[model samples]
Target: MFGFGIVGLLRTIFRSRSLLWSLAVYELRGRYAATLAGSVWAIVNPLVLIGVFWFVTAYGLKVTFEDGPPYFLMVFCGIVPWIAFSEALSGGTNSVLGAAYLVKKIAFPMEVLPLVPIVSTVIVHAVLIVFLLFIMAVNGLPPQLHYIQILYFSGAMLTFAAALSFVLAPVNVFQRDTAHVIGAILTIWFWVTPVIWPVDNLPDWAYAIIRMNPLFYIVQGYRGVLLYDQPFWFQWPLDLWFWACTLFVLLLGSLLFGRLKPHFADVL
Candidate 1:
């Protein structure tokens, strides 16, 4: 039964790929539809935030890495993935509720709804990555072969985000508060994920606990590739743990979403 569910889910997603892409494009445009800056805000917002953190940590707090890239680069690598994930999570959590009209349509494949935001964020993420590479080159840190691992790491992040969205979207249909709760959780989640600070400052035990955060693997992976030039396999243990956690979440989300799907229209 479980095998069948997984297979069926994959088939559904594959069949709905066109619809998913269309919706994602629509969502991306809708995000900045009326705004003057439109899509430019995607790059501008993160840059502004990164500038603030760089100033505070580099100047005010006197934070520095003994044998690492500049502070801002570290923060940039870490926050890029974070911004993508957080946006995907927040948007995905409300995907179903926001598309109530689609949910009511019996012919629609609701699984794709959660994926819309993720796909939309991926477009923005690609743009940020290009900007990141440009910055790296300007700072004399030219791109290297190890940067290819970005594809692997990004695929992992997308899978993790999609798994989570599957769980959150259905719940939000029944409990409107789920979206607000997710926002609160993400705020705390961000601070703890080492986006602005180095994990080396933490005690061994604290590092262990923080490593358990699935996002830690992704943020660190981005840094490893862009800054450290370390391959994904360099941290095999964390890689295994991340995949294990992601698979578990994927299974749980599939189960929860499947169980809850039947009632989504009714609830909405």
Candidate 2:
């Protein structure tokens, strides 16, 4: 049963690969179509926010982190991936409704629709990673082979976000409030996921609880590669836990999306 479901999911995306890429590119282009800076805004917007956080924590609060990297760098490491996930999930939540014309009027594989925004968001994510590398250079941190784990972690992040979008996109069409609620939830999720703070600062019991969050797995995974210079496999326990939670969400979300897909046009 699980194998068939996995095969179906892969075939859905794979068969629609061309359409997926085209729609994703169009979505990314349309987002900045009217802006003078165009797609460059994608890079600028996050950089500005990172600068604000850097100023507030490093200078305003006189705060510092005790981890391997500098405080601001560590914070930047976590924030970039969080932003990607937030944009993908939040935009994806509304994606079905946003493209209602396609759902209601056209013959389309609705399953792949949610992924369009996610792919678009990943384009911006790739650019943000370049910015991350530049920051590391300025901080006198040379690139290491372990940085390659970023590719692995990024794939994981996208997969998790896609799974979440599958669940959120369908339900969100039925209830418009799901999108707003998701935004609020992501705001809280960010704070709890240790973006601005280090997980090490939490007490043992508190750490165990917070670590249960699926996003925590990706957030810390980014830090593990970028700041800590640790291979992903080095943390065997975390590797086990992260994949377990991710796979659970994947199955749940896929099942939910499949069940709700037929109702999408009616609701939209």
For each candidate in turn, give its C-alpha RMSD to the true structure in angstroms: 1.4, 1.6
lDDT of 1 by residue, 1-268 (tens): 6666666777899999999999999988788889998877766887787678768877898866677788888888998899889999999899999998998997899988999999989988898888888888998899888798898888899889998998899889899999999999999999999998889889999998999999999999989888988888777788899998887777777888889988988888
Can you give the TM-score per candidate against the true fold? 0.95, 0.94
Candidate 2 differs from the real structure by a C-alpha RMSD in angstroms, to one decimal, of 1.6
Cα lDDT of all candidates, in order? 0.88, 0.85
lDDT of 2 at 204: 97
Candidate 2 overall lDDT versus native: 0.85
**How many pairs of residues collide in model 1?**
0
